[model samples]
Target: MKFCLALLSLFFAVVVADHGDHSDYVVKTGEDLARYRDQCVAKLSIPADLVEKYKKWEYPDDEKSRCYLKCVLESFGLFDDAKGFDVHKVHHQLGGGDVDHSNELHGKIENCAKEGDAAGEDACTRAYRGALCFFKENLALVKQNVASK
Candidate 1:
C-alpha cells in the first residue's frame, strides 16, 4: 500500500510539472526564443522548410508557413484580432516580468505593428507581419541574447 501511494504521488508530481501554466515558460533571452520556437514547431507540426523561412523572417508564401506563424504567435500569447497584439503578455513572457524592460520592448513592437500593413490582411499575412515587426524591432536583443548563450 505504501509503494502504491508513493507511485501515485510521483505520477501527480510529474503531471503537475509538465502541465504547469505558460508563466513557467518565460522567454527572457535569445536562448529562450529559440526554445520557444522549437516548442512551437514541435507542437504545431510545422514543416522544416517553413521553420527555415520563419527563422529568416520571410513572409509566409504558403499555407504551411502561415499556419506555422499562427501557431507561434498563439503560443507566445501575442495574437489577438480585436486588440491587434497583446503587448503586456508579450512583455511578460520576453521580459520575464521585468516591467521597465517589457514596457520598452512593448513600445517598440507597438510602433512597428502600427506602421506595418497588417490591416485587412488575412490570418497568415497578419501573423507574418506581426512576427516580422517583432523580430525586426528586437533584432539587437535577439542577437545579444543568442550570443551570450
Candidate 2:
C-alpha cells in the first residue's frame, strides 16, 4: 500500500511540474499584454517613453523595442529564439481556443511565419516581423483580442 501511494505521489508531482512548465495561458486582454510588457520592460531596461509610444501603436522599430516584443511573446509562450513563434499556441491564445477561429488564424499565422523567416537571422528581428505582420493583417481582430474587458 505504501509503495502504491508513493508511485501515485510521484505521478501527481510530475503532472504538476509539467503543467507549471507549460502554463496554459490565454492572452485575451489588455491587462494580459500589460503584464508581459511590464515584465519585459523591466527585464530589458527598456525606456519608459518607448513603451508609452508602443502602447500608442507607434512601433519604434528599434533594437530594444524589437527585443521587447520578443520578450513579451516569450512570456506568452508563443515564441522562442530558436523556434520563433508557435502558430498553434498563438492561434489558441488569440482565438480563445475556438476551432473556427483557429482555422481562420492558421493561414495568417503561416503567412507571418514566412515573413519572419525572411527577416534575416536576428531572432529579435524575426519576432518583430512576425508580430508586425499579424497586427497589420488583423488589426481589428488583434485590437479586439487585446482590448481590456
Candidate 3:
C-alpha cells in the first residue's frame, strides 16, 4: 500500500510539472509563433510612444517579452494557458532579430490574465499594435505558407 501511494504521488508530481512547463513557452523556427503573432499585429497597432521602450528588451527573453505581449492576446480574449503564447513585442523590443513573434503572443496574454488591469490592457494593446507596425514596416512580406483555417 505504501509503494502504491508513493507511485501515485510521483505520478501527480510529474503531471503538475508538465503543466507548469506548458504554462510558459518559447517559439522555435518554422513554427506558427510567427504566423499567429503577425495575425494579431495585423489587427492591432503598437503605441508609437512605447516603441522605443519596447526596443530596449532582450530578444526572445521569456518573462519581460511575455508581459508586454499578454496585453494583446488577452485583450482580444484569446489568452491561452498552454501551447498558445505568441509575442510580437519581442521582435521590436529586441532590435528585430530573426526571431519568431507569433508564438510569444500567447504568453503576453497569459500575463495579462494573471494581472488584470485597464492599464495593463492599454499597454499590451499598444505594444501589440506598435510591434505589428514596426514589423510590417521593417520586414519582408510574411510568407503565407499555410493559410489560417
Clashes of 1: 0
Report the lDDT tens digits of candidate 1 across residue range 78-118. Answer: 66555565655555554555456335677886776664446
Give the local distance difference test score of model 3.
0.41
Scored against the true structure, residue 65 in model 2 reaches a CA lDDT of: 84
Model 2: ten consecutive residues of lowest lDDT: 18-27
> Against the hidden true structure, what lDDT does model 1 obtain?
0.64
Worst 10 residues of 3 by lDDT: 140-149
| Each model's total of backbone clashes | 0, 0, 23
- The order of the candidates by lDDT, greatest first, is 2, 1, 3
The candidate, 2 or 3, that scores higher on lDDT is: 2
Question: Which candidate leads the pack in lDDT?
Answer: 2
What TM-score does model 3 achieve against the real structure? 0.26
**Local accuracy of candidate 2 as per-residue lDDT tens digits, 36-144:** 8889989999988998887876677899988998898888788888877777677766676543533657888878977887645798999889889988888677777
The TM-score obtained by model 1 is 0.56
- Winning model by TM-score: 2
Cα deviation of 103 in candidate 3 (Å)? 23
